[model samples]
Target chain A: MAGLLDGFLELLDVLLRNRVRTVMTALSVAWGIFVLVVLLGLGRGLENNVRWMYRDDAVNSIWVYRGRRTIPYQGHPVGERLRYTNRDHELVEARVDGLEKISSRFYPPIPDSVRWQGKIVAADFRAVHPDHRYLENTLVETGRFLDEADLLEKRKVAVIGVQIVGTLFGDHPPIGEWIDIGGAMFKVVGTFRDVGGVNEESQIYLPITTAQASFAGADRVDQVMFTIDDAHMADAVAIEDEVREMLSRAHGVSPADRRAVRIRNNVEEFVRVQSIFDMLAAFVWLVGAGTVAAGIVGVSNILLVSVKERTQEIGLRKALGATPGSIVRMILAEALLLTGTAGYAGLIAGLLVVEGLRRWVPENDYIRDPDIELSTAVGALVLLVVAGCLGGLVPAWRAATLDPIVALREE
Target chain B: MIRLVGIDKTYRVGAHPLHVLKGLHLTVPPGELLAIMGSSGSGKSTLLNILGILDGYDGGEYWLGDALVKDLSERKAADYRNRFLGFVFQSFHLLPFKTALENVALPLYYQGVSRKERLRRAAEHLDQVGLSDWSGHLPGELSGGQKQRVAIARALVTRPRVMLADEPTGALDSVTTQEIMDLLKRVNAEGMTIVVVTHESDIAEQCARTVFLKDGRFEGER
Candidate 1:
């Protein structure tokens, strides 16, 4: 214990004697850690942006599309265009296990313009079941969405997007007002906003029953969208296969026909995106670690020069009965002090910057709340200590192996 | 108590080997003050290094208090040096960053002495060397004689069996050299075995016994 204290004192004395050089070496390490942490935080920020993009819709939802048949089945020729009816939706809902909420949507063949008074604005028009609002992440800004009475009674009630309301209604209230669509007047029941920005918000939603009865001319749906239970989300691919088989049988299409049906599972896509972010995180760590390694090499080189400069002092200590181990300990302790102190300073500074960004930076599409993981901070500190040890090893070995007689003779 | 039989040391300068010490034999009994004198390149420093265990001999049998000091590990050699030998150099060799008391306490530190006890004993040694008031002063603040005196106190603080002084007063004036030699004489009177290596005949005359070296071999003893 006494020897340890003496070694610490010796290290302190040596560092105090070379304060400028010591601080410079320490700053190099500090800058390395700082760059690493900031890069990692930026990486995390980008990942968070991707996650936020999926916030508007259920990550576990799946969208199934009707395509032309690729396989002939039971007198049906290959390349026959497939169409989905209400029966297919009912069949899949009855047969597919772990099915959460399901909705079918139909869109007009051409862009439709909504007319209120003398103003007319071109907008997207989609007719969907009442469950579509929940599946599509439509947050009602005013009034309420279409209910069972609207779908069941075939009521002529329309829910308008906020952009649509802004474009046609001006300063007047949109709800309870009549909007003309294709010469048919429908009452505007609600105004909704989509998380997907203005593009998604410039649309109008009406009941599928009303659209099919009034314009589509038959029971036809362009797409079927549904979500799976949280517990079954991991098996999203299998659930999609089951859904495709059930729909194929109902629509008289071959199950083996790849083009007959298309399943876009958001759960699977979310998982894939998560893996991509994981790889990105790993890459950031590699770059950060490389920077830290370079800093460690810088420290090692400086320590080697210091050992060369202190040849006589080392010789005097050796002659005064300091063992090789003591000499090595002294050098290592000095290195650890330099790296640990400087690295922590960098860590705190980086964290403060991250916190500052989180608190003050305005929200943008590409980044939000940039910060590093707790484990990453701890790992960086550990790296600093290990790097310090590695940085000291070569110089300490050189000092320990120095022959006292030859060293004393050095001028 | 020290002994050396057929000690040999050689230095390889470039491709040629310079034989620094050749089959040298010497002994210093307890409480004896011995001086080794020689001109430059006569191997006096090399012989002194061998006696102080600061350098290894190419071939020799060295005994310090019945322990054979041959081919010892660096750790064991350091232990032996700390336990049995103290050294003073011509340049004082005090670490410039340390206060005089701290420098004097260094050898005791390697001996695992507590800081309080080491400082206390170091203070006593500084008082003995008449540098008690300069204990807190750094080496840069001290005069040549005072620095040499602090170096001498450092050498004595560990209470080693043998004190080796290599040109202990070579950098001092004649008066300071005489004062250092008088201090060495007083230390020797306290039953401490002392060996002073110098090229000065006057310094050699102050010791109880004097040995002269020429071309790496002892010429005669007076």
Candidate 2:
């Protein structure tokens, strides 16, 4: 009989007076959504960890390291070690299709050998081509990476990692400063960082041509690494085959010998890991939704009980001239209001927890920055509210359909 | 004005259909205070239910004013009850949670009256029942006689054409029962049409007219 607002106030009167029962019902609802949010956030954190693992290298790159041994093929000896040279790098550059950036890591046969101002900088050293900057995921902090001119001119310039600078330079200016590497002096041109972590940061980079000419005295390189263009990333396996065939033919080795040409198709590994995370994401949503559904069922069950307890009251309302429609409306409104408020409380609690994890836990090798999008959180809340209403429906209908005379029968 | 022609009602208890009311005819003229007396199992409650539109009759034409109220849907029945009939139960069914004022205002609420006007008219009705100061009290806080007065105020708030009381004093002691009958008589003297169903001779004798129900049919008029 009341207006919408008055009816709503009446609903509050009933709910608020039965404080313990209402809170108990709402608590179950809150717990359900709470589990959903926390689980989703942790899943996102795990995915972030997986994504962070790939920061070590460009996800689309391919690597061909020095082969172990080749099968005897076409009059070649069976146990010959497969050696890659400058010619192998050149042949791939000319013949490979859709190669974006190519480089070679030419080790100079020197170990534990970099020092400056008589201080052992304790760094790994790599003699690499100009594009090794991109192939190795290098972020230059100061000055610049090795360029084509640096390789062509065989300049003795080095790009040291940031950690290397702190050790070798010791607060002195590093750019254009001279550093000792196995009795040779190379001028530092830049300092850099790598997502590959502190170990990569403590290493050093130098021109490949200079190392080949100065140290090995031959066109020897340890590895050829390259990233493919976005257009060809999907066809990476085919390109790997073409490169392998050409390299085996050029080096006089068996094309079918897998060990002769040691190739690592990073794209395949990345895609495999990516599909795993995708499946994990789907699972998280399923579990979260199931939990929310359980909460909705709880809401429905509690409301059904409420309707049962108020049967005589409903009959009294009926006898007092309230239409069945109005009675139904009143109960439905109560259900919606209960769910809306409880769902919102759970969402806010989840967001606060996620934000707290982000601030406190920060970053780790796994589960970095546990967080969820605001839109996703709100979307979850709305979904729970709707499902809650459906849960309330059976009871509301029961209340409306009761025969007033029977309902009001005195015991 | 109210009229009933050949009214019939039946109840089925676990595959056994019990006939509660036979074909019966009655008419209540405008502004007449009337009583219907019957013992238990005499179908007085069933008759009141049919009259109040809280239950449907299996057969009959019921005319409240000019409208024939038969085979009415629950919705239509509720509308008729809200506009035409007000009920007072023996148990004084004031909603336990609402204040006395809110209970009184409920009938007006069914009429779609605004809250302010519903409150005003409800307050006036409480004043008429001599319980205006107790309007803010919940039913749990009120005495037996005071609760019945609140029920009366709720019934009268909509200014219904007919006030129906089902053993309105059945739950009260003798003194409180007399106090309630006095209030009903004062209401009847104001020219409001009223119908009360009871078994007590004293209650019926106080009404303007009385009818007796034996089984389902009217036996005689007094």
Q: Which numbered prediction scores highest in DockQ against the true structure? A: 2
Colliding residue pairs in candidate 1: none
lDDT for each residue of candidate 2 in B84-162, tens digit (9 for 90 to 100): 8888999898888889998998877777788888889989999999998999999999999999999998888888889
C-alpha TM-scores of all predictions: 0.75, 0.85
Residue A178, candidate 2: how far off, in angstroms?
Answer: 9.2
| Highest-TM-score candidate | 2
Q: lDDT tens string, model 1, A1-411?
A: 266666677678778878887888788878888887888888889888888878888888999887887888978888787788887778777877788888988885644788989889988888998888878899999999988899899899999999888889889998899988877889999999999889889989998888888885489888989888878877888988888878777778876786788888898998788778889878987998888788777777877887887888889999999899888878778888888888888888888888888889899987877889968876876776687678768878888879888888788
Native contacts retained by model 2, as a fraction?
0.73
* CAPRI quality level assigned to candidate 2 from its DockQ score: medium
**DockQ of predicted model 2:** 0.62
Candidates in order: C-alpha RMSD to true structure:
6.9, 4.1
How would you encode candidate 2's per-residue C-alpha lDDT over A1-411 as one tens digit per residue? 557787777778877877877798778877777778888999999898887888788888999987756588887786777788889999889888889899988778876657877777688878888888888789999999999998899999999999878877789989988888877899999999998888999888989888887786489888898988988877889988988888888887776787888899998788788889989999998998889888877888888888888888889888888888988888888777887888778888887888788889855777987888878877777777777777778788888888898888733
Residue A53 of model 1: what lDDT?
78
